[model samples]
Target: MIVSLAISGYRSLRNLILPLGRLTVVTGANGSGKSSLYRSIRLLADVAQGRAISSLAREGGLTSTLWAGPEIISRAMKQGEVPVQGGARRSSVSLKLGFADEDYGYAIDLGLPQSDSTSYFNYDPEIKVESLWAGEALSRHNQIAGRSGPSVKVLDSHGHRVPVLQTLASFDSMMTHAADPKDALELLVMRERMRSWRFYDHLRTDREAPARVPRIGTRTPVLSSDGADLAAALRTIQEIGDPVQLEEAIDDAFPGARIEITVTDGLFEVLMHQSGLLRPLRASELSDGTLRYLLLIAVLLTPRPPPLLVLNEPETSLHPRLLDPLARLVTQTAERTQIILVTHAQTLASQLSGCEGCLHFELRKELGETVVDGVEPPRWAWPKR
Candidate 1:
């Protein structure tokens, strides 16, 4: 479980540190940087997959995502005594993201690429520094591995510093490059843990949504990010996972309604058996809200849960009456996996307020920077470039 998360110089998040629990609910008003925080976490996950540079490019590159406000918002500016203004540069441009569980922590720093005449991808972001440490907090003595520029180093068995590799590409991450069992075993473990992190954002329920159509059946233990394999996943759960919990989740949302799967020629489709209906309704005939609810059930009740699961606005297209059941499902799933939910619905947030072992955070913009309400910022130190 991640105990803490930190981000700096990303959009409205000039400097922010958040404490995380088993089930963390991040809520705020519109334009309060909720989406930016979600994307930042996704960017961290992309690093483990060696797609961090490309992910930033898809968001318009480093400069476009960098914080637009002044580097520092002084008390004078806050008091309206002086207008906020930028002074002479005091530090290099940096965008950082990191998280830590009870036993491990990892952080990465990205900066502008050096001036190069031979490369066409000069605008690309480069990994300036990366650190992987043991225990809850990062310290000089606890760092197991470190990456600076193109060089990588790790602690030997005798606790002596040994160079692991050189010539690591700036666009690549150490998680992808330093996978040697002899020199950097910790890197491999950290990489796999990060790769297991799952995210779901805006599952489609439109007329042509993939979940609505029949797809070739496979024993799916994990639901796809787009929920395209929802039927197979739910079916797999019923056969191999906790079928009772699945049934309870469905009944909790819609009483006397059960889900059925029909497989023909290896194609799997979902069917619904509801009260007061002569014939069962197919996935295509189910309402948008009902389809989305089923998708959430399949996700939360997965037989194989990831180490971390993130849901961006699971309440989308859901009616107010369904929020309580959805919240209950999320709360129950958090017991087996660390979950972060970013929502814009007060009803959903309120529904989760009474859940045990859940953390609540309301983000708000202060002088164009995102800050957590009623919480002190955690102490954080980044590796120098």
Candidate 2:
């Protein structure tokens, strides 16, 4: 489990440190940078997969995503722009993100590339620094794996340097590259951990959404990002996973309404049995709220839970009455894996906070920077360069 997370120079999240728990809820106003914090976590995961650049490109270029605030501040400068403001950058333009897990921690630093004349991918950010330490939750102690630009090195189990030094490409991550498997064991472990960090953001329930359409059945232990195979996922859970929890969750949400997945020929479909209905309704015929609620169920109660699960804006289409059921479901699911819910709904946040075990972080903007409410500065020490 991730105990603490730190992000700097990413969007409006300038130097923000947040403590995590079994279930962490992040709530704030529209522009308080809740979404930015969520995406930064996603990007940190991307970095370990060597897809950090791809993820940043998808968000926009790195320059556009970096913080836009002034490099330094002063009392008079706070009032107005200083005349002698040289605009000299104090530190290297770096967007750093990392998290401290149970026994290890990992951090990555990305910066703008040196002016490349011929390369068309000049806008791409380059990995400047990456580190994975053993247990320095308070200080920079054991150096398990460390990288500086192209030069990469690793520490053996005995905390000694490996014989074979390695070189990594500017565009690639030390986690992806590096020769000799045993040399970078921590990096490899960190990479796999990051890849296991699952993210679900706004699963659609529109008229033409894939969750409402029929798809081929298969043994789906995990739901897809688009949630197109909702039936197969739920059916797989009922067959191999905890079917009682699945049924009870559904019944808890809709009273007597239970879910059943049907497979005709090769296509998979969903039949929702609700009370007072003459006949069970199909997935395509069910209301948007019902389909979305099932999707949430399918996501939370997975047979194979990831190391961390992130749900963004899950309360978008859910009715106010269903919030309690959803909150109950999430609180129950937290027993299996770590969860971070980034939401805009105060009611859902409040309800989840009132749950048995949940750590809530209310984000607020202070001088254009996002900070957790009532958190003392430097309460959580970050892994620094």
Candidate 3:
């Protein structure tokens, strides 16, 4: 249940704070920074997995992803009286990201590493500061733990600063290295919760897609990112999950169509049975749109829902008629888990915007920075480096 998300110095998201709800739909035109926002959330998830540095490296390092705009977009620049340009440094180069739930908040600061002649990874970004605080807003008094440079400290039960680590690696996150279950139980809890957040980007439904191939079956409570276990996941839903909802979702999209799984030896494959068909169609025989719709159904109806689920442009390849059914599925899934849907389709966005506990954000570029139209950002404060 993240209440707010704050990102700064990341691509077009230069100093952006967004409020979240049980179901948050983010939509905007092309080049409006929707993809940047999606990648930023994935980067935050990488931190909890101790792969933040490598993730950034794969994206061409901190310099490539850092905001390209000036430190300040002055009134003169906005008025077209002056061009946007960088000025002398007012603060250190830092890329910050954070999120706050109902009871706690966490933030991390990354900056350029100090120059070193002997180090090959000198250009790697360093974790400058990390903070975990109580409540929705971060303040001095609510901070439970703070990590500065290579040192980590946490507040004990009696509210005294207790040293946790003396030399944490610059690439490793405190969420992974300093979250001791004994001394820093809050860190451990937060770390695990962050790890539980699931992300599903564009699912492949091509001829050779993994979801179309038969795979060994298991009682899958969650669908894999590649949807390799689509059959097992659907079978799991039929056996232990909400079978009624599963059938309804399938029928909603393809009127009289239902799903069946056949097992040969240990391999399971998905089959579709539709009205007025001589026989069921194999996964490989299904159309791209149909297969994608089934994949979405499997994902949204997961038996073991994650704390947070993010879907990036899920409406891709889906027919306009299927958007309503997909929206209905998302609305139902939001009841059990927090969902953030990044989409460009106004039809899909319109269908879910009116639902209860849903927040809609239409992002637009203003002077090369992404801004939410007609919405004030929630209260957020980044930890000073």
Candidate 4:
């Protein structure tokens, strides 16, 4: 499980370190940088998939996502004695992200690309440094792999640095290019673990949502990010997964209601069997809240649970009455997987207040930077460029 998360120079994150538990609930007012923190985690996962550069470009590149505030918010500025303003940068322009579990830690540094006349993608950021180390904290003695600029190196059996590559692209990640099952087995293991992380944000339940359309039947152990395979996912659970838990989750949300899947011409569709109804309701006929709730059920009860699962604003469009059931489902899922829930609903947070292995954080903005009070930040170290 990830014990700590560190992000710097990313939007409102500025320099933030957050401790994590088995079930971490991050709650805060709007504009308190909740979404930024969520996206930073996604960015880290993208690195393992070799999509980090493209993901940053899709978010309007480094300039748009970098912190806009001053390098230092001085005491005089906080006292209102002087206006907050930027000064000559004392360091290079860089954005850093990292996370650490009990066994290992990883960090990456991204900076502005060097001036090049041969390329036009100047807005694209270059990865300056990457490090993978042992234990929860990074130290030179525990470093297993290190990359500087275009060169990559790994530790040998004698704990000596062995050069692996001299031409690794700046847009690529060592997690993808330098991992060797023979020489760098640790990199391969860590890479796959990071790739197993899953994220869900703003699942659509509109009239044209994909979940409403019938799709070909296939055995699905994992729900797609868009929930396009909702029927297959639910059917998989009923077949090989914990069917009792799925049914209980449904009944807990809507008393006496259950789920059914119908197939016609090899196309599968979801149907809801509820009390006091003449017939079951099709996925397209169900209300937005009902469909969204069902999607969450399919996600949380996945047969193949990921190492990490992140849900952003899952309470959206959910009724107040359903918050308790949702909280119960989340806590149950956390037993098998690590979960990070970012929510704006105090009711949901209250429901999970005293659950086992649960940690709660309330974020707020201070001088345009996100801050969390009353909890000690976890020990973390970032790889230098």
Q: Please tell me which model should have the higher lDDT, number 1 or number 2.
A: 1
lDDT of each: 0.91, 0.83, 0.93, 0.94
Segments in model 3 whose C-alpha atoms lie over 4 Å from true places: none
Model 2, range 17-127, lDDT digits (tens) per residue?
777889999988889998898899999888867789999999898999998887655667646656424387878888988888888887888899998798899999998
Colliding residue pairs in candidate 1? none
Candidate 4 deviation (Cα RMSD):
0.9
Q: What is the Cα-based lDDT of residue 265 in candidate 1?
A: 94
* Model 1 Cα lDDT, one tens digit per residue, 56-86: 9999999999999998889999888999899
Positional deviation of residue 107's Cα in model 3 after best superposition, in angstroms:
0.3
Candidate 4 residue spans exceeding 4 A from truth: none
Task: State the lDDT of candidate 3 residue by residue for 1-385, as single tens digits.
Answer: 9999999999999999988999999999999999999999999999999989999999999999999999899999989999988789899999999999998899999999999899999989999999999999899799999999999999998999888998998988999999988899999999999999999996889899999999999999989998889999999999999999999999999999999999999999999999999999999999999999989998999999999999999998999999999999999999999999999999999999999999999999989999887778888888877
> Candidate 2, which segments miss by more than 4 Å at Cα?
74-86, 136-140, 163-165, 179-181, 377-385
lDDT of 4 by residue, 182-263 (tens): 8888899999999999999968899999999999979999988898999999999999999999999999999999999999
* Pairwise TM-score winner, candidates 2 and 3: 3
